[model samples]
Target: MKSCQCYLFRPPSIMSISSWVCLLPLIFYTCLAVGAKPASPQNVNVLSLNTNYTLTWDWDYNSSDALPVSFTTEYIPRFKLSSKRVVVWNMACEESPRRSCDLTPLDLHYLSIFILRVRANVNGSHSDWVQKKFCPDTDAAVGPPSKVDLGPAGGHLDVFISDPLTSANISMREELQELYYHILYWEKSEDTQDLRSRSLNSSVNMVTLPNLKSWTWYCVSIQTRYDFYNKFSSFTNPICMQTQGTLPWWQIVLYFLASLLVFFVLMLLILCGSFWCYRIVKLTLYPPIHLPKHFQEYLQDSPSSDVPRLLTPDSESELLCEVTVCPEPLVLEVHQPPPEDLEEPHPDLEPDIRHSRQDSGGSNDSGIYSTGGSSGLRPCPSLSHEGGRTSCQDIYDPQQVKMKDMTPGIRSQLIIDEGVLDMSV
Candidate 1:
């Protein structure tokens, strides 16, 4: 058998100054590394709330020093031998030293226990990890569901619920599948109305309350229930709703008529606008025709048998003379006065001349013809004479007369009948 032994050597007071300086620094750093490393956290405890865990611990350190301080946390499923998982450090505890941290995202099953560990660090130095063990589902206090919504669905009220969750990704565990809903509703008035209630299954987030009075305001509230291991949540804030009653016939008719009238008015406006636009486009594309100025004047001439008074009286006599003159002269006749005993007593009376125009023959009985040829003849005037009345008659010319040289005024005045002129002037 063999054994090994070691001996200690002490430095003398006469050691060189350079050696003392280097050894002094090495000794001071060694003492600081051994004694000034941050202490492990103390009194590590877990505060388990429904679906969450709050971890807290105690530490003693001088914060005024320049030393940077922080904490690291980790958890294990149940027994000490299981591998540890680092709880993602919450942003709330990262900046400075923190004695407590909220470790959530917990799979809070009653049968599952979690072991948590926390440690402190100063600069690059770290201490041992302090450990605590607790089961969140069995230890955490219970809380109420977050909110509820109530609305009218036909003659009933539809209730909707929202529950708080510990983690973003919660699986369908048996404990989570046990939510129950209870609803209570009552009519809102002085007179008593029977209270109604309804219960719903865990999987249904919405339930309908039926058998409600129409046109009545009803108040309602809901509460949630879970396993007896957790306390029941408080009732949600109350809400009020009203059911609609049947509408009257006249009101329905009035609304229908109003809608129809509005539609008709809109259609009428659109049609009118379209018609106006069409007219504008047509006018732009194709304009109207205007008659020549002289043609318009010719159409405006008066229909008569006398010489047309074309010029206004205020016009110069030279214009009148020019209008009366013809390019070529034709034979014009004047009837001589009949003898004294045979003339008509009423000289101003004119014979009916319309029938004479249609007759084909000429009469020589009351003839006062100035020319023997058939060309020159005029209507006999009723002349005043010494004796009684003469019987009136007509004359016609069977031969056609060519219009040779009538002045413009005379041409304007001529009344044509079957290609014959009634006026000579």
Candidate 2:
């Protein structure tokens, strides 16, 4: 291998005057470009409460002739600053008119480090960025306790506090590790001169105030404290409570007994009222039947004697009549026949007829016939001629007829005339 000689080129120690003249204008232009830029923000700060972040800066605009200035805010991970590789900054607020911008939307982790920058913009130009270093875990402010409660414990008052929570609903104590509470209590009065305060350790969330006055009003307020970070939150809104005095054992027992007595009396009244209502309902639903006064009296008098009488009805008496009939007298009427039909009289009958005529003595003229006493018969009358015929009718005598006794239900009459008989009932 052949050895090769190496020579280092050396630059001139001094520059010419013409060269200086030529570079002077360029340098002046560069300085002017830098000087003409808008002023960067001053006193830049990052304020954090729990996980919420805000970037604020101070800026003064002295010249009214210049255009109105606006601010822009950005953030990047702190570790990326030392890396040679290019990394982009996250824009939190763009050209905002306000001096502060909310950085919570970036969701920066509490345990991670971040860098925040703010700059001013006027007309179209931007100033150099003003930077701040932030670690939410250490730099964030502890917020006031989320909740506060006051309770009475005999003569003491108990104060309960709840720790602040991050946006993730995680307790600040879990993240900070060294978290405590600062409690301030005072009597509810127009004057606050009698205020008292207490500080709790990281281990406990409750504090008891001893030797407090009984039956008196008190007020309380709580704040979160992080000793390691030297952070203290603003005090919470005041809460009011009233302390109670301890009761004697006898008084407590008496109260309990009185309550029991009242309850028992109420139950008794309810039972009595229920019974009364039941009785009324039963009476309304079921009714008894009563008999009429007259009917009841009649039944009680004599049921056996009155039953037959009650079955019979009243009516008018009936009248019975008996009829007696007398037998009619017999009447004999004789009609004379024609001469051609006449026959000779019998020898024995002529004698009897002559004797009857002799006894009659010719006094009878009605042509009635009657048997005389010679044969135990009534007297006979002479015959009379009418229309060229001789006829004879027997005389009727009411006294000669006999009246017969009739049975109770029989009504009849007997009549005999011209040898014919008729009976009617």
Candidate 3:
């Protein structure tokens, strides 16, 4: 047997360094002429699809490197790299600059979490696998399409074809690559539990159902699927909704009447509001009234007058003129009774009085002393004045007391004027 020795040595001399420098430009040109690829491979960027049962891969190529035309995707149920492992297909990568591919983990062993990797097939020769640790996975899928909304919405499945949902939609994203979807329906609720209904597997999101009862609520359940377990998952929350029913003529009429009534009510409110607004605008633009010139002058000049004279007892004459109103006086007559009644003549003009005298005065010798009102005594005879003013003295009348000769107004004023004081200054 012959033994071979390997030598560990440093560069011998400056001669080698000089020779290498001289050959650098020629090497560079030759590489350029031949379109030579760089020696370093681009590092693979592995991404765990957020749903985490799946993975996608991409790479940033070294500017000097040649890109591989193909890729291979693979996964392992366990963390270890061992003889027992899953190998997905090797295929051409997307032709785009940064090559990418999605790999679904093959987990027949029913792994809760798996390890995934992507490899570039450089010239039909695979590179080292780039791996993501702990890719999450579940045996679950999106629930079934909701039972058709049979209420106000049109239950026609074809309606979705015409009007696509812009806001609420069924979207497939790379992050959710671990899951897929299915739709199913059955006459019996139990049939859906087994995922055995042939009515399922629709590509469209909205489903149009058949045999739904009119004006009745139905119990419908949606089930999610888990791919690795190959089983239908827990049923989704049951949805209950009432379906549309045939409209009776009376109902249709009632609906139209109700709609018309609502429209009329709204119109009436709007009309009233408009009129109110018009009145308001008119008030603002052209006020309801304009004060007289003098009144306006007074208002503009004095804010002090707003405090009324009636509020202050010590107000001046001008305030008194503005705030006070004088009430007219009422008068009653004052009469003096005649001496003893001899049957009075002109009885209508005379007052009749019945009197009793003290016994100290004899019967005819008794002088008459009048008591009570003037109406209790006899009238005095009329006296003719030198000025030709006839004065009627009805001494016995309670209703009228003769005032030497005063007019009703003056007499009333004389009685009432005694009690009051004019404080207005």
Q: How close is candidate 1 to the true structure, as a TM-score?
A: 0.44
Window of ten residues with lowest summed lDDT in model 1: 363-372
lDDT scores in order: 0.60, 0.69, 0.44
Considering lDDT, where higher is better, how would the candidates rank from best to worst?
2, 1, 3
Model 3, 1-425: lDDT tens digits are 12332233554579998999999999999667465432322444444322223344545455335644555555555535454556543332333233555443332232355554565544434456666555343432333333333233432221121111111243322223333334343333445465433334433445565655565444444443436535443444444455566788999999999999999999999999999999999989998786785775555535445542233455455356656775433332333323334334335432343232333434322112233334222234554343444444443333333334445454223222221121110
Candidate 3 Cα outliers beyond 4 Å, as residue runs = 1-199, 226-229, 289-425
Candidate 3 residue 38 C-alpha distance from true site, Å: 51
In model 2, residue pairs whose N, Cα or C atoms come closer than 3 Å (at least 3 residues apart or on different chains), thus clashing, are 370-378, 370-379, 370-380, 371-377, 371-378, 371-379, 372-378
- Number of the predicted model whose lDDT against the real structure is largest: 2
Give lDDT: candidate 2, residue 352: 30
Q: Which one is best on TM-score?
A: 2
Model 2, span 1-425: residue lDDT tens: 12332223344346765798899999998687556888788888887898888888888787314578999888899999899999889889999999999887778888999888888887777989899999987888889888888888877788887878887888877788877776777667776575555443434787897667898888877777777768898989988889989778999999999999999999999999999999999889977787886776555546545442232233222233468996654433222112221243323233333321112344321222234211222232544556665544444221232234546575644443432223232
lDDT of 1 at 240: 84
Q: Residue 352 in candidate 3 has what lDDT?
A: 43
lDDT of 1 by residue, 1-425 (tens): 12332223334455586788879989997787667757788888876545666888887765316566788877666654543654342232442467888776444455687677788887777888777777755566544556677777767777776664555434323345666666666777665565554444444667777787777888777766667565465676778889766778998999999999999999999999999999999899988788785666555555433244465666656555544654543443323223335544234323432122223443211212222344433344444333355543434332323445666654334434432334333
Task: Order the candidates by TM-score, highest first.
Answer: 2, 1, 3
Q: Clash number for every model?
A: 0, 7, 14
How accurate locally is residue 409 in candidate 2, as Cα lDDT from 0 to 100?
75
Q: Clashes in model 1: which pairs? A: none
